[model samples]
Target: MTGPTELPVPDTVDVRSGPEVSDQLLSLLPLLGEWHGEGVMTGTAAGSAQDVRFGQWMRFSHDGRGFLAYESRTWRLTDEGRIVGPDVRETGFWRPRGDDDVELLTASPEGLVEIYVGRARTTTSWELTSDVVARTPDAADVTRAVRLYGLVEGALMYAIDRAGADDPLRPTMSARLERLR
Candidate 1:
């Protein structure tokens, strides 16, 4: 896995106000708060059930350029709340394109560089597709993932798709998460 790198500074002149960021980006802001949900990760090798809690916070600033600077920290709960996974920190930039689109660039140790194209679907919902690529030597063995984000009833819902194996067929795992404030 890779670690964070110092991002190249941008060249610019504006600090405040163009068109307020896209609704798609705004819709994701609420997710900045704490979120607790149960996640089940199952694979061909083994499976386990455990309580999962994730916390996140995001801040947007200006780097003198037209881009909105963004950074966030995520924490995973473990050991009856006594332990936590390595704090997953994500730093990136967001920029609103035309009237309905926004672009997000991010990197993580998972050896992934992601470019997310977000489109507003409605007043309370939006959709985003991430183009992800692995940067490691064993990248060929990794599969691509497509994620869908939407609100069901009043809860946040997510779905993922991965390249399926050619061998014996089996159902893929999918999950739904409700906001627990």
Candidate 2:
């Protein structure tokens, strides 16, 4: 999207603090930082119950633009208690359509792409529902997803629900992350 005609758009904007952000995005300021945490994932893989403990690192930042840049990496814990993998990595952008409406476009190396429509419930909370779910021919059979994010006790907390091919929607993951910066 182009900048408002009245304000001249710069050729480049410093991601940190170089330019002013539109007011529409201000409601999401609480998410503009790095966060790290641990969580447990429970589900069935191919009809077998699978549970895993994972560590996550997520960052949401801006380039003085209207949208926030996003990136997340997760590692699985081994039974013996060792951290391994970046089993999953996702990159995306969160664009505020208005004070109470937002959009998220995300892509994962695992061959999944998603667009989520979110509604702000409060200045620091949002409920997101997938508008589209596209996957590469070889990607996992994820068919639908929903997410919730909020600031609870000064920490970022989130939960995700997912449904795959022939699978019912179920809670997939949830985590509480401390802001690192």
Candidate 3:
């Protein structure tokens, strides 16, 4: 992708009394809704081969703004497909830098904060590489990460890979979520 360019300002911009979406956010409009689905998480956790089925609920909404607000909650599932308990939660914002470039700012309850920068491969897809990864003193030693998101068959699909001080980049998690709104 090309370097960032100055985005054009609208002739007039003002707050609306009711919900409204901005043209700058139209590229990501497909994700402006709630999504729910289930998948599996497989990797090394707690020094063991961590493998588990899970369910997730994700939401992307805007308040007459230029960026989309994002939040996700996941739950562990029993072998019989029952939700056993809460697993992980994340909060973030998907900010479009221009027509192509975008930035993702996210934090995990697990004490990790990540910033990813990349371009929108398409109106419905993005491939991002971590520009900065920060961790709390008590967090895991994550050093690198990559993420991909796209709309496949009308479903939101995403995958993530990560590496730590002692490991190479490897698959962390992936899932397909169906829009609920």
Candidate 4:
């Protein structure tokens, strides 16, 4: 005759908190809208004097989780007005990491692994540094890049500084973006 049976309990228990989202991530709602910008990229296979027209659009969405997913598409044109080989698309996630920092995780087909830390500078400005890792060995890579985004003269302006390169005088890219709203 069976006297008694014991049920074993699992080691871990799942807890639900009805979508715990961060306030910092919610502040990025304004960036969700459409943005148009024109810029030029130099230091390609061509010489430094070559110019290209650039246009980019960034969008943000949520997937019922605490993280906000973002995608950015950019196109480059030749100096003679010819389309480049392919458009660049970067897919990533933005989420609050700690008290005063945000984390950005992204992956690209060009063997780019990116992780950025965001810090708020002012009410409408922020600074970010992306740690980039290359999947290939021969790529001229940068360990990290410091980027500042702010409004100057009613136009969106950005500056980038790349560090951890083999060369100290490596060329950097800088552009000013006018908000085409």
Superposing all C-alpha atoms, what RMSD in Å does each candidate have to the true structure?
7.5, 6.3, 9.0, 11.1
* Top TM-score model: 3
Which residues of candidate 1, in runs, are more than 4 Å off?
1-52, 62-66, 138-143, 148-181
Better of 3 and 4 by TM-score: 3
Candidate 1 vs candidate 3, lDDT winner = 3
How much is the lDDT of residue 162 in candidate 1?
43
TM-score of 1: 0.51
Residue pairs with colliding backbones in model 2 are: none
Assess every candidate by TM-score: 0.51, 0.85, 0.86, 0.65
Question: Candidate 3 has which clashing residue pairs, if any?
Answer: none
* Between candidates 2 and 4, the TM-score winner: 2
- What tens-digit string does per-residue lDDT give for candidate 3 at 1-181? 7855753432112233335677888677777788999877774642336677789999887777788888999998877999899987999998988888888999998999999999889889999999999999998789999999999999999988889988999878788999887
The 10 consecutive residues of candidate 4 with the worst lDDT sum are 9-18
Q: Which stretches of candidate 4 lie over 4 Å from their true place?
A: 1-24, 44-51, 80-82, 131-134, 151-157, 169-171, 174-181
lDDT assessment of candidate 4: 0.57
Worst 10 residues of 2 by lDDT: 6-15
Residue 149 alpha-carbon offset, candidate 3, angstroms: 0.6
lDDT of 4 at 14: 14
Residues 1-181 of candidate 2: C-alpha lDDT, one tens digit per residue: 8667653534222335546666667777778878999876774521327777788899987657688889998888776769977666899998888668989889999899999998888988999999999999988789999999999999999988889879998888888899887
TM for candidate 2 is: 0.85
In angstroms, the error of model 3 at 113 is 0.6
How many backbone clashes are present in model 1? 0
